[model samples]
Target chain A: MNILTINGISKNFGSIAALKNVSFFVPEGSVYGILGPNGSGKTTLLGIVTDVLRASSGAYKFYDGSKPVNEIRKDMGVLLETPNFYPYLSARQNLNIVAKIKGCDAAEITKALKKVNLIERQHSSFKTYSLGMKQRLAIASTLLGDPKIVILDEPTNGLDPEGISEIRQLIKLLAKEGKTIILASHLLDEVEKVCTHVAILKKGELLVSGDIDGTLSKKHGSTGENLTEQKEKTMMEVVSDDLEKLAGVLKTLNGILDINESEGVITVSCHTDELTAQQVNKHCFDNGIILSRLTVKNKNLESKFLELTK
Target chain B: MLHLLNIEFLKLQRNRSFLILIILFIVSVFGANYIVYEVSTNTGHIVHETSNKSFRLFEFPEVWQFVSFISSFLLIIPCFTVIMHTCSEYTYRTHRQNIIDGLSREQYITAKILYVVSLALFATILTVACAFFIGMLGNDPISFRDFRCVFYFFIQALTYIGLSFLLALLIKKAVLTIGIFFIYSFLIENILEKNLNRLNTGIENIGHFLPLSSSDHLLMFDILKTAMRLANIESYAPENAYLTASVIYIVLIGYACYYLYKKRDL
Candidate 1:
């Protein structure tokens, strides 16, 4: 079941359009990532759905078996932009305020602090926390009340490598506990690794959205096919002592769809069944070119993302 | 509403600035009472000669009026406190967080109104306690009429603090909101009142209808005039008019705060 559905949502800041007819759905128990470049309205869309900002047009609904958004929000935690809390208060005190706001038991504060690994420093003031710790405390606030859905905007932004990995692991752990997580991030690699489904937005418009594997696979022009399935055309890289001659001979093959040379390597895309390694090897040898390396490569999300977004 | 207030109070519980503001308010209240007590008791230097009836500042009904007047001078402290508390949410962006955490916009505004109400109640309670202490120490007879000033005192505090809340909501910045509030209360309103009255005798009484002056007129504390029944000096406007104007201002300010909060994006 879809947990949240946003349809035709748009926002305008006076004359400037921020989000234009943006639409997406977050499925239950799925790690959904909203991916885009900066100023792509990722944060604006999140703000609209979370009630931090009202949409200029369109509507969104949280499907929690007929529960009101307010009640649903009690079971849904959100961290937007930054970790907003009273800086004068300690971490525990801040979480205590969250607990009260959510009408949850105070014991959840301890549990949340423990989850964020801030139990030791729970008494320290929020102003004294490092940026990474501040982000972690924000994550911990979302963990309070054992929320069913958690929305984090750029959860891994501005963290050290170790802190990034720690947050990545924590997100995976939360997903393991059957919680649906909606994360917005510009870090393509992070979204690719951590998200099960994604929606790429650009200029306040949704470019594409689907399951991670399916989206990437579809972008490479092999629709509804497993990533490993050999398609009509397969990409292969070859290197030889006579790089120029290998490129010339490879272009002469009947099944060759496209060919390009880069850094002494010739990348060839050809009909999979017609242009086998044996055919390429023999043709190269017959042409006085000794093949040094040849291997088939599976496309990655980075390449597909660059292709689609570009 | 109760839950939201609980959350707001919890946030304020550990706030060092809020604590200091509360302490400062208490000290100012006591200090004002002390000064009044000293002036009333040591009358010889000012009075030139002792009369048959010794002038006592805390004399029962007069004490309530005196305390209420002294306390009104310090109303700016609570107004500043209310502005800080209301505007800090915007500064920290916790107002947005609270809505994200499940509070409706109306609930957010209601929570702030509750905070203002709480502060007004605190000020009213302190005024009544100070009045009682002074009355007891002076060995004066107390009456229900004296306690009526405490009611006006509560209304006055609510009026001022409610104005501050409205300013905070409209401005959303602590320094700017407080600055505008102080200027309007101390200078702008006074100038407008004087100038408007000077423009025509037909509307000479219009100045008394202005928010701050209207509320301030609620508790008249001219001890000398009240004791001597001076013929030349004008007495305060009828109490009902002042009370009615103050209540109207409070409602208007409260509605304005709610309207701004409801219409704006947090």
Candidate 2:
């Protein structure tokens, strides 16, 4: 089931169009990632759907599409841009305010604090928290009221490596509990690791959106195959002592679909299932061309993102 | 509305600045009233006399007027409080957080309006308490009729605090909003009223309806004039007219706040 349906959403800040008729749907129980570079309207799109921003022209509906945005928001947990809470208030007090606003029980505050592992330090004021703790507390806030849908914009924005991994694990755990998570991130590696579905946005416009593996595979010119099957088409870089002879032999090979040389390295694009890296080396050796290096490159989101975005 | 108000109160209860401001208001009101009581009952001083009757500042019937007039000056405390509370939401970006947490725009405005009303009501109750304290301390017998100024003082506080809320909504910055608020109340309105009064009585009559001065006119406490005449003169505008104007200002300012809140992007 589709949890959110955004239709023709557009937002303009005076003259600059932040989001231009952008539209997408978040499916139930999927960790949907909104991938975009800086100034790509990722935050703007999240703001519009969460009603923090007024769209210049557009409409969006949550849940069954029968409730008002505010009413539906009661079931959604959102953290946009930064962790916004009263600096003077402690984390527990801040989350208590959130729980009160959502009409949730006070016990939920305790549970959320525990979930973020801040139960011991919950009484410390928000300003006293370090950046990692602040981000963790923000993630914990989304757990209050046990919301069915969570919208997080750059949840791991300024965290250390350990903190980033912890947030990524938390997101996966939330998704495991059957919550629909919409994560907006500019980090390709984070999305690739955590998201079940992905939407790539550029300059406020959606380039493509679908299942993460499917989108990556399609962008790689796969014939509607699963990611594992798409992996059959791998490119290997081979540099031989005798480059001219190695290139001539590679071109004659059946599995070698395309061969090109730059400077001294010969890159051979071939079907991995038909021709393995060892076979490429064996073939070059049989031709009396000694090889210096041979490395296989499997296509990943990083490469696909750069290819499509570029 | 009550739920929103409850959340607002909870937030305020935890705010140190708000608690400090309320304590200051209480202390200032009582301390000022005590000083007035001391000066009025002193037998040695004879500032004014009417038919050989020395002026009694804290005497009942007039004490209510005196208390209300003196306390009204401290309306700035509540006004500043309202400004700080409303503008903190923007400064902290908690206003956006509140909406994202499930409050509709109208509910947010309603919560703020409720807050302003509560502060006004609090100020009114404090004034009444101070008046009763002074009346009991004085030798003059107290009458319920002496407490009519309490209602005017309530409306007056509402007008001032409501005006503050409107300014905060438009300005969004605490310091700038409070600056504009002080300037308008202290200087701009006075200048305009002075210039208009000089133009002609007709223009000055219209000037009495200006938001701040209109409420100030509600509780007219010219202590010297009242002492010389030995009678409680009514307000410049009829009591009902002043009350009506105050109610109108509150409603208009509130509606304007709601309109702006609904239209602006958080």
Q: What TM-score quantifies how close candidate 1 is to the native fold?
A: 0.86
| Local error of candidate 2 at residue B102 (angstroms) | 1.3
Residue pairs that clash (backbone atoms under 3 angstroms), model 2: none
| Deviation from native of the Cα of residue A131 in model 2, angstroms | 0.7
- What is residue B209's positional error in candidate 1, in angstroms? 1.5
Clash totals in order: 0, 0
For candidate 2, give the docking quality class from DockQ. Answer: medium
Task: Give the interface RMSD values of the models in order.
Answer: 1.0, 0.9
**In model 1, how well does chain A match by TM-score?**
0.77
lDDT of 1 by residue, B129-229 (tens): 88788777766667656678889999999999999888888898999998899899999999987776666767445787799888887877666547534
Scored on chain A only, each candidate's TM-score is 0.77, 0.79
Model 2 agreement with the true structure over A58-173: per-residue lDDT tens digits: 89888678888888788888989888889889999899889988888999899989988999999999989998898888888888999999998998888899888888888898
- TM-score of every prediction relative to native: 0.86, 0.87
Error of 2 at B111 (Å): 1.2
Off by over 4 Å in 1: A213-304, A307-310, B44-56, B201-204, B222-236
